[model samples]
Target: MNLYAHYVKRIQDFLIALVVSIVLSPVLFTVSVLVKIKLGSPVIFKQKRPGLNNKVFTLYKFRTMTNKKDKNGVLLPDEDRMTSFGEWLRSTSLDELPELFNILNGSLSIVGPRPQLVKDIVFMSKEQRRRHIVRPGLTGLAQVNGRNNINWDEKFEYDLEYIGNITFINDWKIMLKTVLKVFCKEGINTEGLATSEDLGDYLLRLGRITEEEYTAGLEKSKVLINR
Candidate 1:
């Protein structure tokens, strides 16, 4: 019934990603070198994230933090490891440029729900999981709406709305808004944190699920991660 999601949208995503990657190659290269210099080796960070139909795929981004640990050998918190340069990269969203390769490889789209960490997917409610019905996007309705400023529930709602309404117009509108938001540097962070609040914490605080349920979900998620 949905022609765009079934066919045309992917073609559009492929074309747009290809063209954008080529056009932004210089920026990508500059970011890569800077990341190497500022963050040390491994300029690109790769992690498993849930993609289309909740399938796991390797997501890429520019490295923005150091791998420093405490005397106990425990890694430091994100806020501590993140450098001023890293913060700038995040604010400008240059860190996400490497995802062009993900789009090119057909693991992502130009517009859809942002892919989430595989471990986090375990905590997603049934309805929230619906966001993965389509391929993850480089920039999405949630990203343009408020990015990290919004709550996890709001993000899930926006993602579902986009899933239900897929068209050239909506896609382009989201993309345009994303570019504008990026330039304006809107919703770059939640409060003063580097990212939004964790959905697991949100669920737990709302009494939506108990500690036992959370632990069970983590176990289930680990199985998915292995697969």
Candidate 2:
């Protein structure tokens, strides 16, 4: 890795994330209150994601869905539980504000590959997994390019492209693009879906992986998460 990727980038990420978080503190507070009222308790949503070197880290975001469930106590589908308020939070990217702390704590950078689910990583090939060589980001090249709108293969291609050519100039370019992307409300979800398809599911749908492989990957991911 270059000096910037190896050393300078972390310092840059920390300083920028710190300043941005402080400047946005009021906005953060207001959002938190609104979320609590709208989404109920636990306004912050936490989930396990794979970070650098496939290490597990807890990713935080503002909760954008209710805990509504079926009569059998099964959680409803994301779309069914989603409300207009939550949709607005997602479209405005306000739901992502809490991730600033992830950056502050060194689990993320301001720019790099976005951290994906533990189950998602289990389905990635060795080359695709190279994106994890660096800390995952708050916003990334893939995020700015097309986010959940693009197919999984395209996302991985963009991620690998970013990794192969990390530079200070490139990071800034991506960050600036990310701001615009958020404002434009671009690529928040795949067409006709409340959430992007999981990698294993996508691969199985395309016949790239068998059902056995998909189930095994999910089981492996569970083990990794427990570890």
Candidate 3:
């Protein structure tokens, strides 16, 4: 790995994330309060995501959905639970502010492949999994390029491309593009979906993976999570 990718990037990510967190403290506080008011307690959403080398790490974000459940005690679909306030938070990318801490703590970078769900990791082919060779990021080449608007195949393509060409210039370029993308409220969701489809679901829907494979992959992901 280059000096920037292997060593310098972590230092830079920590310093920049620290400064950004301090500067955004007020915004973070305000969002926290609003989330509590609108969505109740547990204002922060925590989920296990695959980080560098597929290591499991808790990814944090401002909670954007309610915990309302059905009579069967199942949580409602994301779209069903989404409120206007939550939609606004997602569109403005305010919900992502807490991830700065992940960068600060060395679980992420300012720019790299975005960390994906633990379950998604199970569905990825070996070549697709190459994206995890480096620490994941708050914003990534895939995120800046098309985010949830793009297909899974295209997203992995961008991820691999970014991994193949890691440079300081590239990171800065992606970061600037990310700011613009957020401001423009672009690619926050896939068409006809509350959020991007899971990799396993997308693959199964498209017939890229068989039902047996899908079920097995999901089981494997559960084991990873349990570990």
Candidate 4:
């Protein structure tokens, strides 16, 4: 790791986060109130997400879905329990506002590979595992380019590419393009979900397909989940 580069990145992240948080405080506060009322308790939904080097960090974001369950007390599917407020938050990209703190705290970068649930990280191939070499981001090459509509293979390829060429210029380009994509709501999600294909769910349904097939599917999934 480049020690000076890391520190420079961290300083930039801190400055941006501080400024953005202060500037967006009113919006964040309003969203918080709405989430509390509409989504019930636990206004901020915190979860363990894999960060740089596959380390774990408690990621913070607004609660976008309800905690409804079936008769057996099992949680409902993500698509079923998605609330109107949640959808709004997702469409506007407001749900991710809290992650600014994550960036400021040095747990993440402003731009890199997006973090995944720890369990999701387990299924990654050796090549895909390279994403952990750097701090995960709230947005990245995959995000600005394809988002939820891009397939897994494609997303992983972009991730690896980002890692290979970790230049300030490339990061800035991604940041600029991300703003446009977010405003246009391009590549947001598939027909039902807010992001990405549910590959983990697919594995369950497909049973034990060959490892080769699974790897192929994951690659496709990365792109399909992007915008």
TM-score, prediction 3: 0.98
Per-residue lDDT of model 4, residues 1-227, tens digit only: 45534677778778988999999999999999999999998999998777887777889999999999999999998888888879889988999999999998889889989997665665677888899999999899999877878767678889999888877777789999999988998877755555566545445445745667666666754543442
Question: Model 4 segments beyond 4 Å from truth?
Answer: 1-4, 191-195, 202-227
Each candidate's lDDT (Cα)?
A: 0.88, 0.93, 0.93, 0.81
Runs with alpha carbons beyond 4 Å of true place in candidate 1: none
Candidate 2 residue lDDT tens string, 1-227: 89999999999989998998999999999999999998898999999999999899999999999999999999999999999999999999999999999999999999988898999998999999999998999888899889999999899999999999999999999999999999999999998899888998899999999999999999999998898
> What ranges in model 2 sit over 4 Å off?
none
For candidate 4, what is the TM-score? 0.86
> In candidate 3, which residue pairs clash?
none
Q: What is the alpha-carbon lDDT for the whole of candidate 3?
A: 0.93
List, residue by residue over 1-227, the lDDT tens digit for candidate 3: 79888888889899998999999999999999999998998999999999998899999999999998999999999989999999999999999999999988888888989888999999998999999999998999999988999999999999999999999999999999999999999999998999889999999999999999999999999999989
For candidate 4, give the lDDT: 0.81
lDDT tens string, model 1, 34-58? 8888889899998889998888999
Off by over 4 Å in 3: none
- Say which prediction, candidate 1 or candidate 4, comes out ahead on TM-score: 1
